[model samples]
Target: MVTKKAPSAQTAVDVALAELVEGERRWAAIPLSGRRALLDQVRALTGRHAQRWVDAAAGIKGLAPSSPLIGEEWLSGPYVFAAGLGALSATLEVLERGESPLDKARFGRAGDRVTVDVLPTSPFDMLLLNGFSAEVWLRRGVSPAAAKANAGLAQREPSRTNGVGAVLGAGNITSIAPLDVLYELIAHNRVVALKLNPITDPLLPVLADILAPLVEVGAVRLLTGGAEVGGYLVEHNSVDHVHMTGSARTHDAIVWGTGATAAERKLAGTPKLTKPVTSELGGVSPTIVLPGQWSAADIAFQAEHVATQRLHNGGYNCVAAQAVIVAADWAQKDEFLAALRAALAQAPARHAYYPGSDDRVAQAAEAYPRAERLGPTGERLLITGITPSPAEPLLAEESFAPVLGVVELPGTGAEFTAAAATTANEAFAGTLGVNIIAAPATITELGSAFDELVENLRYGTVAINAWTGVGYLTPTAAWGAYPGHTIADVQSGIGVVHNAWLIDRVERTVVRGPFRPAPRALLHGEFALSPKPPWFVGNKTAANTGRLLAGFGADPGWLRLPAIFASALRG
Candidate 1:
């Protein structure tokens, strides 16, 4: 038997804190242009070292080098960092200029000044859905009063006395933790130190090199170790702010403590100490298939949608759709399931992490013993029959595998909408990305209710007719939901990431995709050869998209026709 050793608590904390201090000083001193240049360099470095990074990441995660998923990660992961750079640059421009135009059509003239519209992108069919929007007050001359008002709206300043940031990287996804670090440093303008989970230790050297510019400039740093290190870092006196992307149980333990400490804290109605820790704990995100919207083709399209969300990264994602909330009266439920099963049957199984994954799946199987199983080595794609209790562990708890739970509610239009809203609001984990698939008719019929649901959903990202995970990679979409009570009440983390354009954000983001066919579908394993793609696998895709968008910018109608056609045809 092979034995694993945990790092000493003191050693881990020391290393993490040292990095944090360095990152803080560096971020505070660096000029915006220098920061931008470093980001650009990192983007170039990512492309140059793409294969090496992928290999290192795959080796550590125990993934096959040739796996399509690995290819996706290699291409889409780094682009998120590049997108972050772009967003940071835009933010800086807005900061320096006092106002930057985002969308022209949404702008209306208020006397001489322009009123910019920050309406989030809404699905074409579901215009009634409440979308998040932020208003940017702009004028030719800088108004001190307006600036003061805008400054007051800022969440927290970088100079706050209690400034501290800790990042806990995900064990399965190599890019997540580092991205979180980037958000804290650039988005929130905070000092940050990242603690690497043991499973992803091999990539630490690569991450160190990739982030060396930030380190050399003192904007970021990385630390490696296990539970002791994590515990010490979270509990350290100097660490005031923290963020983690991992299990909800882990977040609970850190905030509430565990064992004797937890019991004491509970009895006393107080935690060990109050630190503002934020976490992107896992969620059992749901996809609501509204009736009347899906055809055989639509069902097939969405089957790939659900399958891609679950099968991506072997279903280790926090925002991966774990449950499909369908209307009981929907005629195409069985048809959609058939296509979903077929798609899942073809997906490769991932390496089961930690020892209990198999056990967890087995436990889930007992509730719906007939559920189909898929990969991880003859892994079955388990689907539970329609049940009365949608709040069962299979639906509520994070399965962390290819297993999906199905729940049917009796209703067609508004009734169906109400049930989905209730379920998503009450039964889901703290953080979620709720996906609602509605036909044009269904959307029209329940437009008001859908809007209400979108606003009421506790999730961070509520996607319409698309998988919610895409929000993570979209440069315009903010990653975090909203601020929670405290470190203890952190439901889906405190901040956002992957928004390279760094605009003023609302509470949640709503991503609109076509109900029938999207321009690029990375979920169906189709992006392998397509020019347009949505794979969150690597950061290269962002650069490609940026370049393509920039080219399109150069020529709106004529020169970019090929690129536009390629994007649509590729889908």
Candidate 2:
């Protein structure tokens, strides 16, 4: 008997790409029903391994299984992924019936651009995410009729041919990789070669189990390694297209070869990677605070909201609130800052898990030495009085850590909003997302002007009284940067993902939520039943609520609603 040697990493890459080439040939020919069945199988597998998946992620992130922070893993990991599967399954069902998913979609006008209501898509959405709503704004000149016809074009066409696509996963977010795979397969009708980030190597086993449905069929191939393997897959001749969820640095490195010559390549409008590329990149996301007559309760609640926006996942999110813009003359500026500081201090301290997070936090501290270090361990940083200048490090860079910067502008009401929007558009490093926090009275007073303000701000997602992460989690809503980005200057990278409805000509997603929770919302005349969201850092019952939500997402049914509501109410 002779000893056998396993194939090397390079050989594995070659084999995976070769297999995906064949898978892509058959993927387009598979009817809608067959694809739907594959999705259903994956959803079931996700439910079966949901707990193990959450546990593994928690362990990697320094969260004990019993720790409340473990909720972050459950929600961001399996819950959102499961929800995406459910959304895609529903879309497939509609397509199989030879009907448009947008047939019943409500359309409205936003500054001459047509907007389609995407959230609260079903009665279940209403009950689950009660006060939350999202709208997909179409590109200029895209009529509602055109949007309806263009929705799910790949699925509608019978002669569509597909090819192999590569997904370079994000290290920070667990669901980004799988969700990107889902979008590539369903939305683009392509087979995928998913390369997990090195930091997420621990998840390889669980993902292999959960994604076995597609892996077994060769429609998807999961690989593990670092940049060398990733570069190999990206440069593979057989891979037709590539999509990535990471930083612009990584995107640029792949598109234009890194080194001193990379700049010259970018300037010359030439890319080393000839294949079409789509990416979701991070940026300095802003949370614009409009001057308004706010009560103390309003100040406290919104402060926590802002803190959660910045500190969720220990501030590793691409949409994390990097800067909070406020009016310098606002009377309650001090009060709001104090409240926000308290909120930051109250959140439990966790390890800086992501690679280079310590250096990033230290860089923010070094730049702004006077920045306040809050929280138990003093790792949470809050820098104040930052000027909106290109020279400002925080303004020009994505911190990707537990760091928040405050910039105060001189104005009131619409004037402040317009200035802040302009600064956010010009000063921020990327156009991934921005948030606006305005009181109800202020919005009512501004009316159409407020809509105009939101319309003019150039971000993939403009969230009002909500974190842009809500838009990312809403599978029906498109997620990416503002359009018109060329291959040379990929700000937040090009193209959109997680758009289950597959509506094209998308400009951005607008997500709005209640400013207050439950009883307080009722007092504010906002008819919303949701309690503190599970993603909140201080939600006591977050672990329980997130677990229940995961179960609900895995297999949605009326029977699961009560338990979910019960856990959420306590949170």
Candidate 3:
């Protein structure tokens, strides 16, 4: 019997890059219709393998098949990915008809910036996500005509060719890698060589099957290995551009080589890697709870929302809420904190699956020794009475774990909003995303000042009455750090992805949802039918709802609506 050695990581990377380089021009020159067809194939394959994908992810995260937490895998994996592909497919359809996707989109002005309504693009979006709204705010000086002309610039001249690009897949979220691949293929017009993070190696088989259509066409090549493979692909001669969804530490090491010379290279503005790079590096995201005359129900609901923001995916998310800002003088502050503690305590226990999560949590504990340990296994940590100062460790670092911190500020209305905004801007380590939770009456009271504050907030996505994860999942909304970081300082990285409409010069994506769910919203005089979002960690019917939603997303049809609604209403 002859024994064959496994192909080495370097050799595998070489083969993948070679394939992508060969297909680079072909992929870029393919017509929009052909691209859309490929997406259809991917969506179909994803639907077929959806269950296996979620199962594998759940197993990795220590979630049993029967665990409601399995719903997280389903929603973050096949469901959101299918939705993203569907969104991209729709954009390609419009492009094929010789029209910009934004031609019929609603446009408005936020301050001096032009804003295009991205959500509610279809009747289904309006019906299913009734009160949720999102807008892509263009950079200042971008006229409406300019925004229209810039949308889907790559697709307009379908035969134009860009070179091969490298995508460094994120490990935490199953959908992130696939969505990044889609973005590179459709929005950037690049054939991709994707290197899976070692931590997500278990997903190799599932992703290969889901992205089989692209792999077959040579438009994409998915490889798996450690940092050696990633370094090889990014530095390869054939790769023209690079995109990554990871940490600032990783981004810095990639751009400026590590060790003794790293600081020197940074200060001298000399990156070891010369290729143009884009990244979605997360920072210490904040949840600003604006003071409102919140009722008992309001406090409880919003507390759960805050908990969901911090505990989703076991808080391994780049945009997870780390610092929660609330008015110290607000009468309901103590009540809200008590409710949040209860929510955290009641949350299902989850293993710390991510590498270094235990160390990170330990570091937080060291920084705040008095931090409360919540969760069934005491896996969740909460540090309260955080002063709004840059010296605070939570304010300076991104704790990508089930750790939450509360920062207290003085004043109310615009006064509190301004202070909270200032702390969020100056203290947070990154600019990836932020969340603002405000009651309807409070927003109405603040009015134009509120709008101005939102406009001025320097983050990639500003989520109102919703977690920043909502913006991340919304394909139309641009996802990245606030524009203006360089490779040296690389805060939250740079550039945007998952922008289905392909709008150029994006400043930020502002997403807003109802302050409360249905029945409660009605009681608060807000007209929205949305129930507890399936992504909520405490959502009891999430497993069923997420499954139905995944099917609908993959193969959208009117027939699927009732089942989804039935499951969601119970949650």
Tens digits of lDDT, candidate 3, 12-43: 88888888877876776677888899999999
The digit string of per-residue lDDT tens for model 2 on 391-486 reads 799989788999999999998877887898889999888999999998888899888779878988999999998889999889899999999887
Model 2: how far is 561 from its true place, Å?
1.0
TM-score of 2: 0.98
Q: Which rank order by lDDT, best down to worst? A: 2, 3, 1
The count of residue-pair clashes in candidate 1 stands at: 24
Highest-lDDT candidate: 2
**Stronger candidate by TM-score (1 vs 3):** 3
Taking the tens digit of each residue's C-alpha lDDT, what string does model 1 give over 486-536? 554555666566554444433455665555443233343222223323342
What C-alpha lDDT, on a 0 to 100 scale, does residue 163 get in candidate 1? 53
Return the candidate ranking by TM-score, descending. Answer: 3, 2, 1
**Angstrom error at residue 351, model 2:** 1.1
After superposing candidate 1, which stretches have Cα over 4 Å from the reference? 1-9, 12-16, 19-23, 98-162, 353-355, 375-378, 386-391, 482-490, 498-505, 518-571
